[model samples]
Target: MAWLFSLSAECGTQTQAELFLAYFQKLSWTLQDGKTITTVPEVMEDNDGNWWCMVVPQGLSENSVKSDEDTPQMREIGNLLYASLWNAPDFRYALLGIEVDLFRTLSELLEDTTIGEQPSNFAGLVLAESIWDLINRPETFQIFKPGYVWIPYPD
Candidate 1:
């Protein structure tokens, strides 16, 4: 299956908001006490379509580096990606998207804070809300791509 991969890396003090917001919308949060929570954190998306936020959980486990190739920035990106993947709802919860973790790892790093600055290249971290937005618009996704998945649309 053809899949899209998104990754984020910091260029400086600015964080990637679009990447973060997309990840945010798809995440499901739970409390330490085992209670479920659905909190939509604050996001700033400009009129030109740039957005991001800081939603990293507190008291995360220590990060383990398996190779010398990992940089501090890369390590942090891995942490954000891990949090995104782990907290992501099952594919069933997605109306038009599927869970595709080409690979998985355990790592820790600080939350991204680089905003208002574009990176040279944004890989897997680029948001695909356009796809979701299209699908969500009154049977547009179904008409365009039939049988993509088995998720039932809200009637």
Candidate 2:
């Protein structure tokens, strides 16, 4: 079963939505067509009355990276790529049918302010390592594929 992360906010405010949009715009991501995405879909309420959005961050795709490669460098690249695409407006909107607002709200609730920031090349590796530690563990993850794991959010 897929686990959905719920935002702490009841019905996210417009201000929150705008902030998420701004954060995504700052990332300056480009689509495969080489066009920059300028907008994201609005936030919506889920079945459980929590605000949420879906995003298929870039590196999550089946072709993103070979999961068999277990090198430190490869793992770092995967994390960085996932983070980058996760914050992209297009990717977020396309996957979730909403926008980055859900992510921003979740980040605030989780006290992870740096979730949207672009990591420096040096820091990317470290961030990747940290990300792996968080999601690669079996206790917190659902088996999505042979080499891929999905981190389930707490209810």
Candidate 3:
């Protein structure tokens, strides 16, 4: 049997980090968090400044990390951030790189997003919705192939 591990995504900042440390007492997950992944990620940023957010910023554990790789807690915070940050029902999120500064506005994300035009380079915006769908239906992931773009959002 295959042993699959799902390392939860963390969100938030400093005080949140302190709170996670306090409550969990210790976090082997964060410590073991790798600087790499197994497969070629659908979304790869070539720019500099985009480190993933690990801080909640506000709320009781405002400065804490959303979870210590805990599934449920992290899911809630992740969803909340979706509504809190953008306030858009269909908003998609992506961890952008320093080069993201080129497009100051959110609408710019859709700029030149012709899926067929750049078959070699996948855009980060569409990758977000596609991944969320994959998270919900991982069975489809097994048949995933290189160069196959999955877009959950309708055209």
Clashes of each: 16, 2, 12
RMSD of 1: 15.0
C-alpha RMSD values across all candidates: 15.0, 13.6, 15.0
Q: For candidate 3, lDDT tens digit of each residue in 62-108?
A: 32333444443434433333223232112123322112222322233
Tens-place lDDT per residue, model 1, 30-139, is 44445333324234333333332433322222222234433333344434444454344221111111122212111111122221132222123322334234333222
lDDT of 2 by residue, 1-155 (tens): 22321111123344454445445434434544453333232456544344533322232222123334323333343343345544432211111111223433323323543333422211211122233344233243344323333332223
Superior candidate under TM-score, 1 versus 2: 2
Instruction: Provide the TM-score for each candidate, comma-separated.
Output: 0.24, 0.28, 0.23
lDDT of each: 0.30, 0.32, 0.28
TM-score of the candidate numbered 1?
Answer: 0.24
Which sequence of candidate numbers ranks them by lDDT, best first?
A: 2, 1, 3
User: Which is superior by lDDT, 1 or 3?
Assistant: 1
